[model samples]
Target: MRVMELVRFGGADTAFATRELPQPVPGPGQVLVRVMATSVNPLDLQTRRGDYRDQVALPAVIGNDVSGVVVETGRGADDFQPGDEVWYLAPVFAGLGTYAEFHVVDQALVARKPARLSHVEAAGLALVGVTVWEALVERAGVRAGERVLVHGGAGGVGSAAIQIARALGAEVVTTARARDHGFVTGLGAGTAIDFSAGDYAPQVRAMGGVDVVLDTVGGDTLTRSPEILADRGRVVSIVDISEPQNLLAAWGVNATYHFVFVSPGRAKLEALGRLVDRGELRPVIGAVLPLADIAQAHTLLEGGSPTEGRGRPRGKIAIAVHPLDQPPHGTGSSGREE
Candidate 1:
């Protein structure tokens, strides 16, 4: 099996190594998938940089999202048969990741891939969709008619959060740059505020304040959320903040805060699958690269180098682990040597 791994946490360029390794066998209640495609999450870069060094060992295969076809099933794993197309978010810190040609995952974490989507599309949506669904629906229980503000609306999680919020019957507002106003609006945001322009709190407050604020972009956004939150409002943050922020304002309104670290489950993926199949949700793919070119995927996601023509990717960076008859989106790593 060909696996792209983090040889050590020395950052993207110095960290990645491609090597042939033995294929894993499925255990009870597990299924062996011949991975078709996987997507890059911001966490991938973090893991490669040793942010979670305690969880990920050296030479780790550290991807969390995948869309693949079942090749075999373990004892008691009767839910999916051979040849079933599936998509899932691999368990975080689980050691085995989705960065290889084959993955042995617990069957309970897998769901039938949305029929209308290609493997690349499903791969792009798995982790980000689950994160948004968990944050807005499961954790916060976002209700219909609520006004919700999504930070970083053009990002992978924020884009999905906007549509999920809209589908839940909430009016949605999002923060993006001037270039993404139309893009975010097209994804179901009622209003797209340019965060780069100035403080977005006043603009959101002008619309009577939000009942829910979903923060995909961290930093001062968390600190300023209280400015736009209605009394007793709920705030869900997916990004971790290390700096100090005054939450004293939250005390005034009895504000409740929820920090989300996504948990992988079949039910969440199944719900997203239904939404995708129904055309109420769509995956946003920024780029698609071959499995070997993993470093470039990280660069594009970080938007680290202007000279490399790398800017923040539009959505998730999809990696094609296996060749497809039809090319995937964004020309990530296709047509290149491994």
Candidate 2:
């Protein structure tokens, strides 16, 4: 099996190396998958940079999302068989990652890939889908007729959050740059505010504030989120910032807060798959690269959205682990979680 290892922590160019490794067999309650596609996320960046040094050992495989076919199953892995299409979040900081040609994951964490999606699309959606599911549905419980504001609406999680919030029957309001207004709106954002252009808080307030604020960008966004939140509104942040944010405003309204770190599980993926199969949700693929070009994938994921007359990406950036017949079809993020 061919694997990309994060051998050193620093620049993307020097951080990873490809190596041939012995194929792994599934353990009890696990399945061995022939990885077809994988996608990059901020988690990959932080892991590569050694920010997660306590969790990830040096010279490790680091990718977190995978869409693949099951090759074989270990003992008690009766949920799937050879040839079954599957998608999962490969446990980060552990030895197994989705960057390799082959991966082994627990059956409990595996879900059938949505029949409506391609391998690349499934790979792109796995981690981010799970993250949004956790934040919006599991944590915040966003409901119909509620207004939800999604920050970073053009990025992987933000794009997915917009669609998922809409599917959950919430009216979606999203923050994106001027370049991505149409893109986020197409994903079902009724209102797209350019956070850089002016005061977005007033605009959101005029529309009855928000029942939920999903923060994909931290810093001041988290600090200021309570301003746009309806009384008792929930704020969920995936981004982990060390700087202390004052919640005095939130206290006045009795606002609830959640910090989500998405964990691998089959139940959440199945819920996402149900939406995908129903055509209520779709993966946004922003970019695609071959497995051999993973270093370039990292670079592209970190780079700012193309400016000027250049196009802004729609979804997640993916890497074809098998054969890449499709280029980065504008379906495709950085270190923390967004």
Candidate 3:
């Protein structure tokens, strides 16, 4: 099987390369998926650059999101048959990835793909959707009538968070640049603040301080979010919150800083699947590239040279792992690759 991998961590061009390896087989309670598509995330780049070397093992296959067909199912995996169409977020710390022709995932972490979406769209949702869902719904405990602020609203997780919050009846406000304000608003944000214009803290405060803050962009934004929180408001950040003590002390805030490490859970994937199948949510694909162009995909993800006339790609960039017509090995008709 053909796989993209990194022998060492460094530049995207230097670290990522294609190689041939033996196809993976399903182990007990696992399933071998013939990958149709996989999407890139910031974590992929970060891991590839040795940012998490102390934590993650070397020579890792570093993708987390996938939409694929089940080619084979192992013992104790009676729930999912060989032909089931599935999507999942791979466990990152364990280092089993989706950037290959086939990936073996625990059957407990897989869910049927949303009926309404293509494999491309489903692939794009696995990681970001789970991240947003966990942050807003699970950690922050966002309620229906609450005012929630989502920072970096145009990015993958931010975009998904906006739609999910709106669907749950939360009054959503997001920060984006001028060009993305309309896009964010169209996604159902109640208010879209242009971060480029000025500080977002005052604007959020004027709207009756937000009940929850979802900070996707950390650094200064994370530092400033606590200031705009309502009394006893919750703050969830996916990025590092460097000044947790200072921020909490100065603002009379009881902060719950979330360092989101998205886990693979079948129940969460099923929830997202139901939302997509019911037309309540949709995945945004910023660009599509062939498996051979994996390097270019990494470049766009790592803030490398521009593509599609934008300085950076807007949403998920997916890599098509297999052609649409082929039926993956070990499966019959229903396992046709998408």
Candidate 4:
């Protein structure tokens, strides 16, 4: 098995090293998968930069999203057999991550890959899809005919939220750059506001504040959310609150706040698969790089140099671990590689 291991906690350029290791054998209730693709998330960037040094040890394989084919199953792991296509978000800081060509995960954490999505797309959506599902469906309980405001609509989580909210019959409004208006709208956001142009609160207020606000961009967004929230509106935040905010405003509006650090599982992946199979949810891939270019993928996600001709990543950056030569939105995997 080949892996891009995090040798140190530092910049993307120096933190990672490619190495060869023995393939892991699945334990009871676990399955070994031949990783087809994996996607980079903000969590990966944080892990690479030492933000979670306490949780991750040096020389660790750190990645969450994985879409692959089952190669072997452990004793009692009857949920899937060899050659079954699957996708999952590896438990954060688990023993080994999906950065390697082969990964072992509890069978309970894996789900059948959505038939409509290829390995690249499934890998890109796994983590973000689970995060958004936790925020919108399980936590906020977003309902039909309601207006939902999603911050950072062009981002991985934000993009998935837009599609999920729309699938729930809620009207979607997202915050994004001027250039991404079309992109967000194409994903079913009814309105796209450029947060940089001016105070977006006033614009959102103008159209009668939203019933739910998803805070992907932290900073003052949490504190200022009351200004754009409807009565009893729910606010869900995935970003960690680094500073204290005045929540007195939320009291007046009867606002509810839920902070989510996603815990991945197969149930959430199955829920997302239902939507994907229905054509209501789709993965938006900004770029795809080979496993050897894992460092470059991190750089692109961190807004660093060498975009590889793309101006900026619009969606998730996926690593082709098995080189399926599959298109971004290809219907399914072509075949297994050895």
For all candidates in order, the CA lDDT equals 0.87, 0.86, 0.82, 0.91
**Best candidate according to lDDT:** 4
Every candidate's CA RMSD? 3.9, 5.6, 2.4, 3.4
Error of 2 at 129 (Å): 0.3
Per-residue lDDT over 14-101 for candidate 4, one digit per residue giving the tens place of the 0 to 100 score: 9889898889999999999989999999999999999899999888999999999898999999999998999999999989998888
**Which 10 consecutive positions of candidate 3 have the poorest summed lDDT?**
329-338
TM accuracy, model 2: 0.93
Return the TM-score for candidate 1, rounded to 2 decimals.
Answer: 0.95
Kindly list the per-residue Cα lDDT of model 2 for residues 1-338, writing each as its tens digit. Answer: 88888899888889889888888999999999888899999888877777888887777888989898888899999999997989998775667788888889899999998878888999999999999999999999999999999989999999999999999999999999998999999999999999899989999989889999999988887778888888889999999787988888888777999999888899999999999988888999988888888887887777743553334356788988877544222212011110
Clashes of each: 4, 12, 0, 0
* Alpha-carbon lDDT of model 2: 0.86
Show where candidate 2 strays beyond 4 Å.
Answer: 304-312, 324-338
Our model 2 lands, by Cα RMSD against the true structure, at 5.6
C-alpha RMSD between model 1 and the true structure: 3.9
Output the lDDT of residue 74, model 1: 94
Q: Rank the candidates by lDDT, best first.
A: 4, 1, 2, 3
State the lDDT at 276 in candidate 1: 82
Please, what are the lDDT tens digits per residue for candidate 1 over residues 222-288? 7777888888899999987789888888888778899999999999999998888778899999889
On lDDT, who's better, 1 or 3? 1
